[model samples]
Target: MALPASSFPTLLFFLFLISHPRCEAAESFSHYCSYNRPTTPAISKSIAKVLSALVSKNPPKRLNTVSFGGGKSKVFGLAQCHRDINATECKSCIEDATAQLPHLCPGQADAGAWFDHCFVAYDHERVPEQHGTGF
Candidate 1:
């Protein structure tokens, strides 16, 4: 006979579970962060929007806001990807990274992701654009 029918369902189920697909837990996205901290909803929303329309992240280009909460909290952020990436690709990466940032950091003000062709960052401090590596 062809193996007991009783075990077939269990075996198939196990196989399905193994190959179905897996997503890293909310905690596992830490590898994509650096020098980040908790942020306000406004900041988070703003960053996410900028990231969504980026044509490139390379050259360490960034957009930030300062003097929040009446006069404290300065948002400093910089996102950089590979200089080789086209504007379209860079934009996509920034959008993707931004969408994931809030979820990855969860209320965090500062966060950054260095992808093969892009990088992103957001924070509440002075993000110096030293070296003139901006485009």
Candidate 2:
């Protein structure tokens, strides 16, 4: 069947829409989880608690760091959500990161993970405070 020229533009538009695949938002991009030997059960638990708290307290796409427990059991945690995403996305990403990291690096004393929407790290030893600009 022959179609009128006026319908050509509409047909072209529809073809463009269907032919182009929708660019899906990524659930995760890449991750880095340390492979250090397992820590004491107390320290592991503390680290888990800190990570849970971080995801629960998702800020306005802001970076947050906290330390909990004490002595050898102390765990320092850091979480940062991509500023470009909304609060909801930020929270979701952080939650996923926190939940998966522990299992991904079981019994590890230091671990870090990065997703498309957020980044998280938990460790028994805190990074040393840099005295000068040397890296």
Candidate 3:
């Protein structure tokens, strides 16, 4: 069966809509949790603070790092979104990443989660200052 020429444009538009990637919720890509180091209550509190800071603070740039607590309880965290995304999108992505980390890496003192638009990581020790250098 042959379709009318008028329908071709409509069909093409529908195809394009499905093929194009839409800016929806952030999607998880990968995650890591260090099993060697178990988290103490102090470390856990620090982790919570770090994650909260990562989600609550809005950065001028795409990347942000946060440190909380002191001594053995200290925790360092980093959150970053893709440069192309807008502030709102970045926030959403970071929020999503932060929200998932605890569940994905429960009981671990060091953990990281990678999302489609952003990345979140936290550790009892300081992470690298540079991005893409690994945690």
Which candidate's lDDT is highest? 3
What TM-score quantifies how close candidate 1 is to the native fold? 0.50
Q: What do the candidate models score in CA lDDT, each in turn?
A: 0.52, 0.75, 0.83
The candidate that wins on TM-score is 3
Model 1 worst lDDT run, 10 consecutive residues: 63-72
Whole-model lDDT, model 1: 0.52
- For each candidate, give its TM-score against the true structure: 0.50, 0.70, 0.75
Stretches of candidate 1 off by over 4 Å are 1-37, 40-70, 128-135
Across residues 45-96, which tens digit of lDDT does each residue of candidate 1 receive? Answer: 5555544434333324543222222223445555554566776665556566
Q: Write the per-residue lDDT of candidate 2 for residues 1-135, one digit (tens) a residue.
A: 999999999999999999886753334445555665578989988887899888878865367787889998998888887667888787877888888888768788787776777777887888312122121
Off by over 4 Å in 3: 1-25, 128-135
Evaluate model 3: give its TM-score.
0.75
Q: Order candidates by TM-score, high to low.
A: 3, 2, 1
| Local accuracy of candidate 3 as per-residue lDDT tens digits, 1-135 | 999999999999999999886856566778888899899999999999999999888556687888999999999998887777788878888888888899898999999878877888898977724336332
RMSD to the hidden true structure, all candidates = 7.1, 6.8, 5.4
Q: Candidate 2: how many backbone clashes?
A: 1
